[model samples]
Target: MKEEIKKHLENAITSYHHYYASGKLAAYIPALLEANPKAIGACILDKEGHWYCAGDYEKRFTIQSISKIVTLALAIMDNGEESVFSKMGYEPTGDSFNSLVRMEINRVPKPYNPMINAGAIVVTSMIKGEDNNEKLERIIDFFKRLTSNEELSIDGKVYLSEKETGHRNRALAYYMKEVGILSLDVEDVLDLYFQQCSILVNCQDLAKIAMVFANDGVDINTGEELVPKYIARKIRTIMVTCGMYDASGSFAVRVGLPAKSGVGGGIIALSPKKLGIGLYGPALDDKGNSIVGMKVLEELSRKLDLSIF
Candidate 1:
């Protein structure tokens, strides 16, 4: 089974590599432009501790928006569900992930969901910390535990790039602050949010983290409950509904797994109690998801009957 899965992953990577040309690097973030647009990788970790990997699985990239899931989980664990949800809704917004239009139109200007930039910023504020440094430390620590990689840390270049050029996110944070949705200092919240987005990871790291979710919040090897069962369940539900930005609905029909995509060309996906998948391809479609990564997952899902729906 290991050999078979590895072969399939290799085939998928080969078949979808050309799709990189159909997409472009996430040029808006200067640091992301440094990624090898042609690099495509995948890893699958099943419940029995088997790992099948192919392509450029070792290439590191920023965790990007994928950090939202961890941050949301940490916030819920820090504050009760009721407290967390009071700042953001769970509904999906068809708009772009970074767009602030919905906030402007709504009578109550809170972000529609934590998956989007506005909502993620608000959720980051909910994380208990005395300062941005402490909050960022907590977030990085959570990520390290989730991936079982104590070496996990931020990409300083990417963090600096995000902090300097993330004008849109800054706008969202300020608006939420003005509307009374955020009680914390806006710059501090944005700093923590940007810092979280810049945490470095690769396909293998992402797969290990996804495996925890696959096991309903428990570490597969150690039997440690990394996240409470209810919180893990809620995170998966939100990923299914909103993880792929505006392209989530179509991704659901085509792939049928709970997954999240990052602009850093990484995607984390899982089939409950079956397997966890991690993919990376820096070239992005219009929706900011990894184009090659999406194609690879679709092929794998079809071949392995891995779709949830």
Candidate 2:
């Protein structure tokens, strides 16, 4: 099985490496534009804790919006489900992940689902902490436990870049505050949000973290329960419905797994009790998803029969 998976990954990487050319790096982020647009990578962790990998799997990139999943888990773990839901919603917004159209036009009482930028900021505010640093520490600690890697830290350059160019995010935060859904100071919450999005990881680290979700909150290697079963289930559900921004529904129909993508061209996906996948391709398609990364997952899903649907 291991050899088969390895051969399969090697073939997929070779076949899809050219797809990166059709997309471009997330140039708007400024810091992300420096990445080699052609860089592509993938890693898979099976249920037995064995790994199969290809391409630049060891190269680190910002987790970007993928960090929202961990923040939601931490918010739920600390404040409970009801408190977190009260501040943010669980529905998918068909608009772009960064779109404030729905939030402003509809006057949404809560940001629709924690996956979007608006919702993610609200979710970050709900995380229990005395200050921005404390909140960020909690998140960092949780991710360390999830991946069993304590050396993980935020990419300071990416964090500052996001903080500077995140005007839309700032507007979203202020709007949430005006709607009575946000209690923390707008900049403080946005600081934590940016810091979380800047968390540094590579394809291998992402697969390790996804493996925890694949195991329903239990560490696949240590067999320790890091997240409660109920919280893990709810998180996966949200990932299916809202993870890919506006393309989530299509991704769900095609790939049929819980997954998340970041503008940094990283995607983490899981099939329950089966396998966890991680991929990075700095080039992004129209929906802000990794072009080669999505192709790799689609090919793997078809070849491996990994769809949970």
Model 2 stretches astray by more than 4 angstroms: none
The estimated TM-scores of all candidates read: 0.98, 0.98
Worst 10 residues of 1 by lDDT: 1-10
In the range 137-203, model 2's lDDT, one tens digit per residue, is 8999998898788899999999999999999888888888988888888998888889999999999
Give candidate 1 misplaced runs (Cα > 4 Å).
Answer: none
On TM-score, the leading prediction is 1
**Residue pair clashes in candidate 2:** none
Q: What is the C-alpha lDDT of each candidate?
A: 0.92, 0.90
Steric clashes per prediction:
0, 0
